[model samples]
Target: MKSVDATEFRVGGSDGWTVTTSFNYNQWAEKNRFQVGDSLLFDYDSGKDSVYQVNKEDYDKCHTEKPIETYKDGHTSIKLDETGTLYFISGNCGNCRKNEKMVVQVMACRGSCNSAASLGYLSCLGVVGAFVASLLL
Candidate 1:
C-alpha cells in the first residue's frame, strides 16, 4: 500500500497545467524529487486541455493517440506507485510540441522517510538523497 504521508505536487507550480508556451514543465520537473509515495496534481481546463501519460517515444513525438493513460477531468492526480521514469504530455499535440511535457524520475524511499513526522521532512530527505547521489556519481 502507498504511504498516506506522500507529497502531492502541483504540476507546473503556480501556473498550473496550461498552454503557456513560456512555462517549462521539464525544467519544473527537474527542480523537484519524486518518490514512490509522491503524487502529481495536474490542473487545467477540461474543455480545452487534457493530460496524457505516455511513453518516452510518444512524449518526444507529441503523439496523443497511443497514450499509456489519459486524464481529461481538468484536475488529475496520479500516484507514483513505484520507482522509475514516468513521462507525461499534453493531449493537445500542439501544446505538447510547444513544451508541455515532463519526464519524472521517481526514486525509491530511503531510510525512514515514510515515518517522518512532517511531510516537509520527506522532501528534505529527498534533497539530501539527491546530494548524496550526485557526490557518488
Candidate 2:
C-alpha cells in the first residue's frame, strides 16, 4: 500500500536552479534531509542550462566532460532510489565553478516508513518525505 508520504523537493527552493551570487545551493542542501524514495525536482531553462549527475571529484572540480546521468529538459525529476551521497553539477562548467552544485545525502528509510517503502508503497514514502522536509524548513 502506498503511504501518502512521498515527496518531491524543489531544488533551490522557489528560486529554482540558476546562477546567482545570492543563491547558495550548498546552504540550501544543508537545510534539508533527503531519504530513499524521495524525489528531487530541478527546474531550469533547458535552452541554456542542464542538470548533470556527477561524482564527488567531478563535482568538486566542476568537470562536465562526463556525467553519470544527464537531464536536458527544462524540468527534471530524479528519484532518490538509494541511500548515500549524490552529487549534482551544472552542465555549464563556468556556472558550476561558481558554486551551482549540490550534494545530497539520502538517509536510509526508518520506522514504519521503511517497511512501507520496502513494500513499494511510494505514496507513504512521499508523505514521510514531505514531513521530513517540513521539519528542516
Candidate 3:
C-alpha cells in the first residue's frame, strides 16, 4: 500500500463555510493546488447552511434539489480519490442564488510519490517505441 499525504482544505477559509458574506471561493480555489487523495473539510453552521455535491449540469444550473450527495453535520470531510473536476454548492436555495458554489480541479497523481514505492513507468516504453517506429515510416 502507498501512503499519500493529502491536504485538508477548510471551505470559506478562516471564516469557515457560509454565505453570510461576499466571500470569493473561486479566488481561494485558484490559489490552491489540489491533487488526487486530497481531502476537503467543510465547516459550517448546519442550522443555517448545508453542503451539496452536484454534477456540473446541476451546479451550473443552480439546481439545489437531487444532489449527488448531501452533508449537514457542519463538519464534513470529503476525499478526492480521482483526478477530475468537482462541483459543490450550498443546499440552501438562497445561498445558491448568491453564488455559493465552488469548483476544484484535482490533478493527476505524480509518479513515485513515496520513496518506498516501486513504479513500472518503463512498461509503457513499448507503446512509445511503436510510435517512434511509425515516425520512421
Candidate 4:
C-alpha cells in the first residue's frame, strides 16, 4: 500500500485508509475530515478504546468512545459507512500528547477467485488439446 505523510495529525494510505493522531480532541477534530466508505484506525499507547466523537456545534455533550473500536496495543479501527465528516479526540489527557494517529487504506483485491479459476481451466484445456494432437501424429 502506498502511504503519504499527512502531517503529524494524519497519514493517508493509497488503499483508502487514513490515520490520525492528536493530543487535543478539539484540535484533531477540526483538522481531520472523514468521508463515506473510509476506514480509520487509531493508535494509542494506553487508551485504545477511549475515543469520542462530537458534532461540530455541540462539542461539549458529545463525549463517548462508543463508535470507536479499541485495540489492546494503542490501536483502534473505525469504518466510515456514512458520507460525512468524523471527529475524534483522545479521552486520556496524559496520553494524548504522545499519541500519534495513523490512517490505513483498505484496497480491494485485484482479482477474484472466479477469474483465477477460469484462467486455470483455460490453461488445462490448452495442454490437453496439445497432448491429443501429439498422440494422433
Q: Which candidate tops TM-score? A: 2
Q: Which lDDT tens digits does candidate 3 get at residues 89-109?
A: 998878887878899899966
TM-score of each: 0.77, 0.80, 0.76, 0.35
State each model's CA lDDT, in order: 0.84, 0.84, 0.79, 0.40
User: lDDT: which is higher, 1 or 3?
Assistant: 1
Better of 2 and 3 by TM-score: 2
Model 4 clash number: 10
For residues 3-92, write the lDDT of model 4, one tens digit per residue. Answer: 222222232332111224523334444465544334565544453335544343322334333434334444546665544444444454
Q: Which residues of candidate 1, in runs, are more than 4 Å off?
A: 1-4, 113-137
| Residue 41 lDDT (model 2) | 98
lDDT (tens digit, per residue) of candidate 1 on 10-85: 9988888987867888888899988877899999999988999999999889999999999999999998988899
Clashes of 1: 0
Candidate 3 backbone collisions, by pair:
none
Comparing 2 and 4 on TM-score, the stronger one: 2
Taking all chains together, the TM-score of candidate 3 against the true structure is 0.76
Model 2's TM-score against the true structure: 0.80
